[model samples]
Target: MTFQLRVLLVLAPILLPLRSSISQESAPTTTPLHRIVPQTPAELRELFRYTATRLPIVSAHRGGAGPGYPENCIATFEHTLAETFSMLEIDPRMTRDGHVVLHHDATLDRTTTGTGKLADKTLAELKQLRLKDSEGNVTDYQIPTLDEALRWAKGKTILVLDQKDVPLETRVGKISQHKAEAYAMMIVGSFKDVVACHRLNRDIMMEVMIPSHAKVQAFDALGVPWQNVIAFLGHVPPTDPSLYEAVHQKGASTMIGTSRNLDRVFHRRVRDAPDSLRRDYQMILGRGADVIETDLPREIGRLLYAPLSKSPLGHRLLRVE
Candidate 1:
C-alpha cells in the first residue's frame, strides 16, 4: 500500500469514534418521564370519572407526533410522555397476515415509506418500511405492532386505540389478551359498537361520540354506565352549555378534539398572541371539557399544566416528574 493509504487507514479508527460521538451529542435526550399509572382497571375507570376536582388531561392524538416523531410509534409515545403525562391515541389496522399494527391511513403512502393499501401488506413486509411524520418527512421509526405498543404502555401511558380497519372485536380481544384494560381503551363511533365492547368486557373503557343532547340521551338509554365511557363532544365546543352539563351530569368526563380546530389556530398564531391562544384552550376547559385531544399534545399539555390536584385520585394517579 502507498504511504498515504496506510496513514489514512490508521486515522479511520480515530475519525469514526469522533463522528459517532458527535451524533450521540446531537441526539434527543429523554427527560424524566411524566407518567400515569393506574394499578387496576377499576382505578383506571375512577381516574376518568367526572369529578369537581379532576385533573385536566390531554390525549395525544396519534401519539403526539411532530416533525421528527412519526404518529403511533412507541418511541413517539415515549417522547410525548417525557414532556407531559398524556394518554396516547393510536390507530390500529390489520395486516394481510392477521397482525394488528399501528398505522393511521388506509394506504401506506401518506404516513410511511411504503405505497398502496396497508391491509394488503403483511406485518413482516411493513417492518421493512419506515414511518413518516406529518410533514411527509421520512423518519427513522418503524411501524409498531399493537401488541408491542400494549406491552410498552403498561406502566407508562394509557393508549386510546382508534378503530381503523381493525374491528371492535379484534381490538377488544387484543386488550383482553394483554390484560390491558388498565391502560388501554377503544374509540367506538356508534352506540351499538359501544354496547358490543361493553358486552365483550365491561371493564374496558371507551371513547364514544356524544356530540348532542339527543345523542347523549341515546347513550344514556344504552344503559352502559357513564364511568365506563369518556364522552367525545366533537371537534369543537358545543353550541349549547347543556351539552356539557348533560354529559357531566351523567358522571362521565368529556373530551373535545381540537386537532381540526383549536390546534390549527394555535399553530397558526402561536408566534403573535401566544397568551391569547392559550386562553382559548383554557376556555375549553373552563367550559367543561375534562380532556383535550389534540395533534399538539406537548404544547397543549404545557399550556394547560395545572398544579397537582388536591383530590386523592388525582394526587395518586396524575404523576409528573
Candidate 2:
C-alpha cells in the first residue's frame, strides 16, 4: 500500500494533464467547412450540385474479385472495400427460397457447383455448392444473399447491382428492408424499369442502364437527368468510340466495360488488331465517360487517380463554375 501510494503520487499529475488535453481535442469545433466529397451523402450531393465539370469516377466490375471468390458474393464486396475504388458492381437474382442472392447468370453452372437453373435450388442446396473462378478453381465463397451483402455494404461503398430479369420492386424492397439506405445503381433493362425507378426512388441518385442508341434519346426526352443515367453501351468496339457521344450530349453518365467478353484491358497490344488489343479506356474516357467500370479495380484506380497529362476543360472556361 505504501509503494502504490508512492507510484500514484509520481504519476497522478502527468496522467491528469494528459486526460485534460485529450478531452479538449475530442470536443467539436465551430469552424465552417470547405470540402464536401470524401464526406457524407448530403455533402456529396451538394458537391455534385455545384460542380461544373464531371469526371467519371472509378467503379469495380463484379466486386473487383479476380478469382477464387464467387463474383457478387460477400467476399467479392469485401474485396472491393479493400481497394481505393469507391464503388462495386454486383449482380442480384432471387433464389427459389425467395431470398435475394448475388449471381450473374440465371444458371448456376457457370459460377456454382449446382446444376440447372438457380430458381430450382433451395437456399440450403445453394449454400452447399462451391464457387468457380475464371481459371476454374472452385472455392468456398458461397453465394451471398442480397440482404446479406446490403447488411455489410450499406454505408461503406455504392453497389451497382446488375438486376436483370427480376422484378424491380422486389429488389428495391430488399434494400428498403435494411433501412440502412445503401446506394443501389440499378440496371434498367427496359423502359418499364426506368419508369418504375423514376416513380419510386426519386430521391436516390440512380444510374439507369441504357442499351440502344434510340432508347437513349427517348429516355433523355422523358426528362431523365444526366445524373440519373449510365449508358451501358455493351461490347463497345474501339472503332466506334463516337457511338457514346449522343448519350454524352444529353449530359448523362456512361459505363464502359473491359474484359474478354467486352474490350481488352491493355491499351497497346500493338501486335493484335487496333480494336482487338487496345482497351477502350482512352476512347470512352475521351467521350467524357462518367463511370468506367473495370475488371481490375485496384489497377484501374491507380490509372484513374494518376495525375492528368493535360489540363481539364474546366481549367480554360472563361466563366468556370
Candidate 3:
C-alpha cells in the first residue's frame, strides 16, 4: 500500500468513533463541576471538535479571572475547571534562563510581586514572587512553568496557549515533550505560523485569527486541514455573514471574542442588566459564532444556559447552552 493509504487506514479507527459522539444534543441542566481532560490525541481532537460545534463552550480568558483566583495561575485554572469543562486561555512567555512560564504581561509588576521585565528573571527568581488576584491583592500562588500548567491540565481542561514571547518551535516542542498535543492548542496569528507549526507536529491543534472571508480563503490555500484549526473572528461583531459559513463549510469552528464587547457594549450600555446581556449574546450567536470566548465565562455560561423564559430573550442562543 502507498504511504497516503496507510495514513488513512491508521486514522479511520480514530475518526470513525467520533461521529456518534458529536451530536446536537442539549447541554445538561447542571454542568458537572469537574475536569475531564482528553487522555489521547484522538480523544482530544474528538472532544475539541465536538465542543466547538456544540455551542457555549466557555473559554476562560486568562484562566477565568475572579476574586481570589488570579489569571493564568494553576489555582485559577483549577478553580475554573471545578465549575465547568472550560478551555483556559493562557499566555506563555520565556524567562532569561529559557524556562517557559505562564504569564500574560511582559512585565511581572502588574500581576506578580516582581518588578521589571519577566525576561530579566530566571525561573527560580520568577517562582519566588507571589501572584496577585484580579483586584491586585496578593495571593500565595506562585508563577508556574508552562510544563507545570500543562501537566496540571491533563484530563482536567483544555488549554489554549497564546503565543507571546515564545517561538512556535519552542512551544510545539514543549507540548510534544509533555505529550500534551491533545489537551493543548496554540494560537497562531498568521497563516505562515499555522503551516510551520503543522509541519512541526501535525497533531498540534491551532487557533487561527482569520479576520475576513478573503483571509480565510488565503488560509485554505495553505493546505492545512480545517479539522485541525479553530478560526478566531476577532473582538468586534463580524460584519460579514459569510465568514462563519465559510469556516463551517471548511469543517472548522469560528470563535467570537466578547472580552472587548463586554467592555464596549455591555458595561457601557447595559451596566449589568440581564436583559441587555442576553440580547448582546444573542446578537453574536445570531452572527454564527460557534464558540464564545469571554473574560466572564461563568456569567456568559449562565446566560447562555439560562431557561428561555428566565432569559430576556425567548430563544436559546446556543443549542447546548
Candidate 4:
C-alpha cells in the first residue's frame, strides 16, 4: 500500500468521529416554544371555564408590544409566545379598500412610519409602511392583516380581537371565514353587541364588560349561556368580591386588565421593586381573576411558567416545543 493511503486509512475512523461530534455541537439550537393552542371551540371554552383548580393565564395586550417589538405585528405575537403560553389581544381596523387590518389607532403616525388617518390608507398603501415599536423605534415588520393574524394564530395562541373601526358583523364574518372559532374571540362593547355576536356565531366566544352587578344582571337577562363569554372586569380589580362569584357561579371565567393601572406600577418598579409588583399580580389572581390582561405578558409569564407547566389545565392546553 502507498504511504499516504496507509496514513489516511489509519486516521479515517478518528477523523470521522470528530467530524460527527463537531457537526452535532454546531447545529442550531431551537428555543422551546411555549403556547396555548386549543384544537376546538369546546376546548377553547373549557380553557376559560372557571374552576377551583384552574391555573391563571395571561392575555397579551397589543401582542405584548415592547422594545424591538411593534404592537399588532405578527413577529411580536411569536416573540411573546416564545416566552409564555398566553393568549394575545389584537386590534382590528378597516382600511379604505375595505380590508381588515390589525391596528390600534385611527391615525397611523403614532405606531407606524405613515402619517395619515388609517382609514384614508388602502391595505396596499399600509403594507408599504413599516410599524414602530412602543418606544417609537421603527421595525422591519410590516402591518399584518386580520386574515394573516388569524391564520398565524391557529396552533400557536388564541387572539382576543379588540373592536376598533371594524364593525361587529365584519369581525364575526372574518372569524367564521377563517374557521377560527377554536382560537379567536372578540371583545364586544355591550349586551347588544354580545347578543349580536352570539346570534352571528354561537361557536365564537367573547370578552364582555360585566364589571358591575347591574351589568351582570343585564347580561344574565340576555339568556346567553355563560360558556359564551370570558367576563372582563374593566381596568382595575372590582371592589366587590361577590361580583367574581356571580360570574363564577354562571360557569364563566373572569379577566381583569392591568395595562391601564397595575401595569403602570410594574413598569415603574421593573428595576427597583419587581418582587412587590409580582406579589400584586399574584394578589389579583388571588382575588379570583382567571386571567390578567397586561402589556407585560412576558413578565407575568416568567412568574407563571413553572407552576403552569405542571398544572392539569396547562398540560391539556399548553404546548412546549
- Cα RMSD of all models vs. native, in order, equals 14.0, 16.4, 11.3, 14.0
The digit string of per-residue lDDT tens for model 4 on 15-129 reads 1112111112211125566778789999999998887766678899999887778899888887787777889999999999999999999999999999989999999999999
Best by lDDT: 4
Shift in Å, residue 166, candidate 3: 0.4
Worst 10 residues of 3 by lDDT: 15-24
TM-score of candidate 3 to 2 decimals: 0.81
Against the reference, the lDDT scores of all candidates come to: 0.81, 0.56, 0.72, 0.82
Q: Model 3, 1-321: lDDT tens per residue?
A: 532233223223322122211112222325434454566777655554633224346788998776777889887776665444468899999999999999999998889998999999999999899999888999998999998988887767778999899999999999999989878999998788899999999999888998898888899899998889888989885967788778877877788788886634543343445455545566566666767788876555544443422333222221122
Question: Taking the tens digit of each residue's C-alpha lDDT, what string does model 1 give over 161-204?
Answer: 99988999999999999999999999998999999999999989
Name the better of 1 and 2 by TM-score: 1
Give candidate 4 misplaced runs (Cα > 4 Å): 1-30, 310-313
Residue 138, model 3, lDDT: 94
Give the clash total for candidate 2.
1
Error of 4 at 101 (Å): 0.5
Q: Candidate 4 clashing pairs?
A: none
lDDT of 2 by residue, 1-321 (tens): 332232223223321112111111211123211111222334333323312255446677777665554577666555444434347778887778787788888898888788899987888888898888645678776888777877766545667667755688886666566653325556667767777766776544555556567777677677655555566766452345455666656655566666553324243332243333223344455544556677665445434442322324211111101
